[model samples]
Target: MARRGKKKGRPVSGWVVLDKPVGMGSTEAVAKVKWLFNAEKAGHAGTLDPLASGMLPIALGEATKTVPYVQDGAKIYRFTVAWGEERSTDDLEGQATKNSDKRPARAEVEALLPAYTGVIMQTPPQFSAIKIAGERAYDLARGGAVVDIPAREVEIGRLEIVEHSPERTLFEIECGKGTYVRSLARDMGRDLGCFGHVADLRRMEVDPFTADDFVTIAELETARFGEAGRGKPSSDGQAPQEEIRLPDRFEDIDALLVDTVVALDCLPQVSVSDDTASRIRLGNSVVIRGRDAPVEAEEACATARGRLVAIGAIEQGMFKPKRVFGG
Candidate 1:
């Protein structure tokens, strides 16, 4: 059998907490980050809609293996709901489908919060990625076909109003995975007897990540192009006045990247010896030492020499490697 060819690009691994601007799709952002780093692999923790802006944690290289952990983490969103009309897609991008003259007052919305605070069933918007018979629901909706989408259980940890007016209301919500802010606005509008839709949406947090770690596209572009110039003016007046050239190496772009182990900070960490790390690298289980070490855990990660070795569960004082880190 012919050997598989080596993949092109560097084996760079880490998380890029992107402050995604509105109008850029999640896939496009991931591709751009991957290209900027020249990484062999890249993926995102969660999908951010083109109409939304905020933290989109992108995984590069070996970091892709830990994508699910970040995806399952709680997320926080700050959004504004425009009253008096409910749109077809539940956001500003869609056409208004339902209209109402009645506007919900501040007190009316506050009273309805308790009903939506806990675990509640939510029906995703028509223009959602939910599959219906192997086809995307959004595709069907775009084709002018209205399909019955079932409601799924989602957890809303906290929901509070930040600002309110007769026209639009701003809100900050902390929710679990699979919770949709668009659906929340739609449901609240329906319950308050005034049709509504999301006017603006911004994700503030994704568990381990917050706005503090976000790197804007402009920052990445600057880092990519900024250092290429020699920072010295040319002797002659012509030829662009200064020397400028392309980056000679990937490190030329000094974009901040969170360590791969940091993404698993929520889980218990077990520091292992070099011998144990060797077993882990071979996808084997090794007995965990130290009296302070956990005897058993549902999820845990083992690190050796200040680097992540593997992520797995602790069973009867043994660390079994489920996912080993190549980085």
Candidate 2:
């Protein structure tokens, strides 16, 4: 194979919501956006199947740092279930194993839907990205080997029957991060004493994002070209530039993006003195004057408070590191 050449791209920092197109894998979409933005550092917050489409958060530049923030967020999808067959992949296009002669009505689907709501244990489909012996489970599945995958906990916050037909069923769901709609369809079919497979799947929303938040590759290109064409300055000598831009508006931009640190807005802010800030910068955990305790700098990452409970007002005063915690 020819050696891959040096990567050439611009660097952009911040999060950009995208409207993913169907039939394209999540990685493909992310690469396309990286090229569109010419950014060297970019990552997607969540993965969507080639058969699925909708709001996918693309982290550009430092925004990628917040991937964990939204990775576990609640998600929603609009999917179509074909009520007569089951496939190896749990969706259409895969080899099907079972078929049914009976048909299910919309009322029946609605009535059975409530059983999926709330906490539920679900078995992930064999054709998925789960790991088996440190290798992708899908790889083993495609090789024709059977894998006895175990069931895992996944929550379906809501499941609604939108439409039903003799040939197909369309429904929507809000579920936990790892819930598989394909598996849900298969299980639904089993419950109905028939067979079912996902005919179509489209993610409609993710935290801080929705179908309305997504941007397609075409749209991203258009936006870039639009910026390139915007030679007219705002005359205030403060418009914006392209290809490379800093997140000076970090506050507002992060408003649309998920927060790396949980409860940032709800947490109190302690003004660190020059010396204290310097010490914290050096990775030293220090104690704040108030709050009844001292904590490592990382602990502030949680709520700006140390190991102890948050005290009263936190004025603009210098603070030391408490403890290092997750963002």
Among the numbered candidates, top TM-score falls to: 1
- TM-score, structure 1 vs. true: 0.92
Query: For each candidate, what is the lDDT?
Result: 0.87, 0.67
lDDT of 2 by residue, 1-327 (tens): 999988555445556677877777777767766655556777887788887878778886655655765777788899999988999999976998998898888777888987899989898999989998887889999999787788998888889988889879899899988898999999999898778999888888777565655555555544544544332222222233543443322233233433333323223445445555456655564456667433333323323332222212322333433332222
Best by lDDT: 1
Model 2 TM-score, 2 decimals: 0.73
Worst 10 residues of 2 by lDDT: 306-315
Where is model 1 poorest over a 10-residue stretch in terms of lDDT? 230-239
lDDT of each residue in 1-327, candidate 1, tens digit only: 999999977888999999998988898888887766767889999999999999999999899998998999999999999999999999999998999999888999999999999899999999999999999999999999998999999999999999999999999999999998899889999988898999999999998987888897667656755644333222221124445554666564544888899899899999988877888999999999997999999889999987899999999999998999873
lDDT of 2 at 229: 31
Error of 2 at 245 (Å): 19
Model 1: number of backbone collisions: 0
